[model samples]
Target chain A: MKVTVRYFAQLRDAAGTGSEQVEGDFRTPADLWTHLCARHVFPLGAADLRVSVNARYVPFEAPLGEGDEVAFIPPVSGG
Target chain B: MFVLQASPLPGGADLLPPGDLACGGVVVFEGRVRDHNEGRAVTALEYEAYEALAQAEGERILAEAAQRFGPVRVAAAHRQGLLQLGEAAVVVVAASAHRQEAFAACRWVIDAIKERLPVWKREHYVDGTRAWVACGCHHHGPEAP
Candidate 1:
């Protein structure tokens, strides 16, 4: 299955794009991240990054569905 | 209609002229641009937002505020882009039949706005430095001087 991944803030700058597609048999959010780390030389460290699927924040082990728009929400401090 | 604006504007103080209705109680909350953060002298602040989501989020909060506070007129707005010190970052106004509901609604709207909204703020320091607040990231890039 193909899953879409998104990065935000400094993560996006590091990854060089806001979104991308990855091909994997991953059934969970953690699986997807493992695939990305194994395949690409991610500019931003993927470990310790927050994960979200379909715009809602989620845990790393969150189940993955095909075509889900997962996003890595970089920590932001705003007031 | 609940209003949410991204452009810079005066705080809720400017909302008083919109209506002088017989509302027994009017409550407003204005968030100002402060001058200090994390022991640094903040010279100015800039805000960036996903506009559509921000508006939708604001309206959602307003609707809930009205529902929770009794029948009332509520308006909430947030300033976007570069903002100088003392400028208004956000304004929330609530007018109701009683002061209690009005105050409660105003407070709810502002707190909801801060907690859930997808807005990011960048703080600019007097020494030509800037940092993203709440950005829980290790500083691996060039440090601001």
Candidate 2:
């Protein structure tokens, strides 16, 4: 399936862009993260991040569908 | 009102819900960017947000605060992009029929925003180094060596 991945903060800095389209046979967000980490060398692991599918917080195991929008949230520090 | 903007945040008074005569007390909380962190002299900070989710979660926090505290008007605004030292990075305003409720609701909203909002901060130090600010509370697994 194909999905659009969005990155924020440090992840965006590592990825060198805010977002990208990825085509893969990914079954879940964790799988996607594994793939992206290999490609972008993200500084943090999935355990330190949260996954949002279609803008709603979900587990890394959340299933991904075609054309879905996914974002990896790093440890938040907003006040 | 919950929003994330690239421009400078408005003053606390401007964030309050206008013309609520029944409210006897209003609380405004402005979280400013500090000049130093962990003994490092900071020059500026950069904030980024997953805009849609951040706004949605922020609005939910305000709504929850009102429900918990009763009859309170709450609003919040967070700053995106770069901010200098001492700038108001966030402003939360809450008004209620009583002083206690207003104060409690304001505090609740800001805390919830910090815990739940999908926003990130990057600190720029005077030594020409920058690092992302991690709250260190979200990680549930084993710590790295």
Which residue pairs collide, candidate 1? A75-B135, A76-B134, A76-B135, A77-B133, A77-B134, A77-B135, B6-B80
Q: Largest DockQ belongs to which candidate?
A: 2
In order, the first chain's TM-score in every candidate is: 0.80, 0.96
**Per-model CA lDDT versus the true structure:** 0.69, 0.85
> Where is model 1 more than 4 Å wrong at Cα?
A1-6, A19-70, A74-79, B1-6, B10-22, B135-145
Segments in model 2 whose C-alpha atoms lie over 4 Å from true places: B136-145
Residues B1-145 of candidate 1: C-alpha lDDT, one tens digit per residue: 4454556765554664447465778887777888897789999987766455566667778888878877877887777788889887777788878898888877777667666555677889989988767643233221111
lDDT string for model 2 (B1-145, tens) is 8879999998877877568899989888888988887788989999889998897788788879878988989999999999998888889899989899988888777777777789888999988999988775333321110
All candidates: CA RMSD (Å): 6.4, 4.3
How much is the lDDT of residue B75 in candidate 1?
Answer: 83
**Range of the 10 consecutive residues with the lowest summed lDDT in candidate 2 chain B:** B136-145
**Decoy 1 TM-score against native:** 0.69
For all predicted structures, in order, the TM-scores are: 0.69, 0.90
